[model samples]
Target: MPNEMNKKQQEIKEKMQQQKYQSKVDNVTPTPPLLKNICWAFVVGGLICTLGQLFTDYFLGLDLPKKEASACATAVLVFLGAFFTGIGVYDDLGKRAGAGSIVPITGFANSIVAPAMEFKREGYVFGVGAKMFVIAGPVLVYGMVTAFIIGLIYWIRQ
Candidate 1:
């Protein structure tokens, strides 16, 4: 009888503690305003696209082919992203710009370099090489798969 009584008391104590924790959690505030974040993201993303277009236009003025100019512009944007991330500026931009910074090719560059930097202390091979692709691996795999599938569909159509 004493054992059963003790067990019941323990259960009630646990239940009360859970309720207390849940109440605390409920009292905590939520994330920032969604509309404001969306606006920032839109603006930042648009600016990046505009910058890339300007680069492309500048290259075109040099008489480069359209495709070559566009590719060069993409390369420039990727370099800027990686460079900023290396200097620790991209993270700040990411925090404020949110998806605005992430929806661009520059964001892809950031993802690749950020992990390598973080894992640098773990050693070059194990730390940097192994973990560098953690963020990009899924993205690359899915992107390749999507491209292949699209290509296959196009081939079949033709």
Candidate 2:
């Protein structure tokens, strides 16, 4: 009797497997709109660059030194990035805008602050401070290391 039950179960399992395979073969996934995504990313990225340019121009119009004005504009942008991330608006923007929202200085700021804010519930010391660099720390370290290696290469070549 147990042998009969075992044989029935194996037949049922084979039928189930065949149905699953047939379902997969019948299902067709539609292609994503890659070109549309690219265009939107370009438009949004251009808009971000335009905003930064406007900020720098505005600071220059105020008679600030060129270098100082650039620094000030960057500072404001970074602050805005961190603020938006803290308020949870930046995440939505990033999702919709894709690379348009990232690939900028503001995005770097957002990356750092988002992790810190996420861990804040753990406590200030272990939470915010410790996790603040979780995302950005490796980037920072690698950037410096790459720069040093490049400098050494240049120096050696000379």
Choose the strongest candidate by lDDT. Answer: 1
Where does candidate 2 stray beyond 4 Å? Answer: 1-32
Model 1 over residues 91-157: C-alpha lDDT tens digits?
9999989999998999999999999999999999999999999999999999999999999999999
Give the candidate number with the greatest TM-score.
1
Q: Can you give the lDDT of residue 144 in candidate 2?
A: 99
Alpha-carbon runs more than 4 Å astray in model 1: 1-29
Candidate 2: residue 19 Cα off by (Å): 22
Model 1 clash pairs are none
Q: What TM-score goes with each of the models?
A: 0.81, 0.75
Cα lDDT for residue 8, candidate 2: 100
Global CA lDDT of candidate 1, please? Answer: 0.97
- Which 10-residue span in candidate 2 carries the lowest summed lDDT? 25-34
**Would you list the C-alpha lDDT of every candidate in the order shown?**
0.97, 0.88
| Per-residue error (Å), model 1, residue 63 | 0.8
